[model samples]
Target: MTEQQETPPTGVSKALQKDIPQATVARLATYLRVLAVLADEAVAIVSSEELAVAAGVGSAKLRKDLSFLGPNGVRGVGYDVIKLRDRIEDVLGLSEGHRVVLVGAGHLGRALVGYGGFRRRGFAMVGLFDNDPAVIGTSVTGLIVRDVAELTDAVAALEPTIAVITVPDAAAQGVCDLLVAAGLQCVLSFSALALEAPATVEVRRVDLAVEMQLLSFERARNAESAAEEAMSAAAGALLPRVSMTTSKGAVVQP
Candidate 1:
């Protein structure tokens, strides 16, 4: 009997052909951000260990992630930081600028508009919208806020693919509905409440409390490490040092 040839998995094949993992793609985007900062300082090369530390990943994991994008690093040396940065930018679909619209003109909305990271990362804020009449005429980050009544018109005019919601929990669903109606494909929400979105629309939530909890955990770990070091030092001082000479005249300390 003849054996049947095995076909490769489509998703894995496509991802491999693109030379990246879904997870690695996300991390590479983060690494690219850090690399951009280093490149601005004129730094040339960075080792996986250093890059991993900067990107908050294990060195081995970082290497594996980069490997998905093909053999990029030199043995015994390191990766060319700028080259890796550019490669990641191309792979993650950030090489070309993307248009984004902001919903809500509150503090978070204003901060998102004023954020330099999005601009640095190749995202363009083409429009800002709010329901309040006062905020509608106000200027934010050089762009005037328009009324929510103009949401559809503004999105249609700007042709934005991404929408950011910074409204209150109660208004989040309504804002999302308007964004969907405006033809937005993706959303980045800052509201504390979870929102139900259509399968076609991708929503990424940025919860403040989740980040604060992570920070609190980090502080606790650091405090524990310091306490352990202090305890070790005190214990070491209490121990008496004894030296003995063996038959070979080699001295050993106990």
Candidate 2:
């Protein structure tokens, strides 16, 4: 009998792998965005520590995260900025363009239509829709705003796979229903209202107020950190100019 050789486990080789976590993949996308910014700044190479800081993660965590995708980095030289960026773009399906339609054409809708981030990230804004006749036929971000009544027709013509709903909470469900009927597979909803859709369609909600609150929390944390640093500086200045050992065995130098 001939001896059989076992195949080595390749990390994240297949799309349907059960081991890789969705959260990790999403973080990888974020890391890719940060890497793009670094590349734009002409950063040639980045250590795991530097990349983690750019991605708002710890070095160890970033290393473990990238390890799941395979050996994508060098030991002493760290990761090549452009190569890692391309690899991540390929992994996140951002290499190909995704067509998107904006519904509502209100403040948030217009902002999203004009958002540079979407364009930079490979999402193409195909069209905009609004119920108001005045806003209809107007151009926002080089795309003509069309009537909501022609939503189905516009979607069919554009073949938009993703729809962004920025309509009023009262009208969100209706807009979502229309989007579903128009054959949209994914929706990035910015409305406050929760919507019910078919099992096949995916909806991601982005609440402005919730985001504002999170930002406020971050500001508070930063303020607290600043206050602590100031107090430490003041305490250091007040102490005698000498090296001292505290009762707790911590060495303090002034």
Q: Among all windows of ten consecutive residues in candidate 1, which has the lowest summed lDDT?
A: 245-254
Q: Mind sharing the TM-score for model 1?
A: 0.76
Model 1, CA-based lDDT: 0.78
lDDT of 2 by residue, 140-216 (tens): 97989899999999888999878999888899999999999989989999888889999999999887688678567
In model 2, pairs of residues that clash are none
Q: What lDDT does model 2 reach?
A: 0.79
Off by over 4 Å in 2: 1-23, 215-254
Steric clash pairs (candidate 1): none
The whole-model lDDT of each prediction reads 0.78, 0.79
The residue-by-residue lDDT of candidate 1 on 149-181, one tens digit each, is 888887878899789999889999999988887
Which candidate wins on lDDT? 2
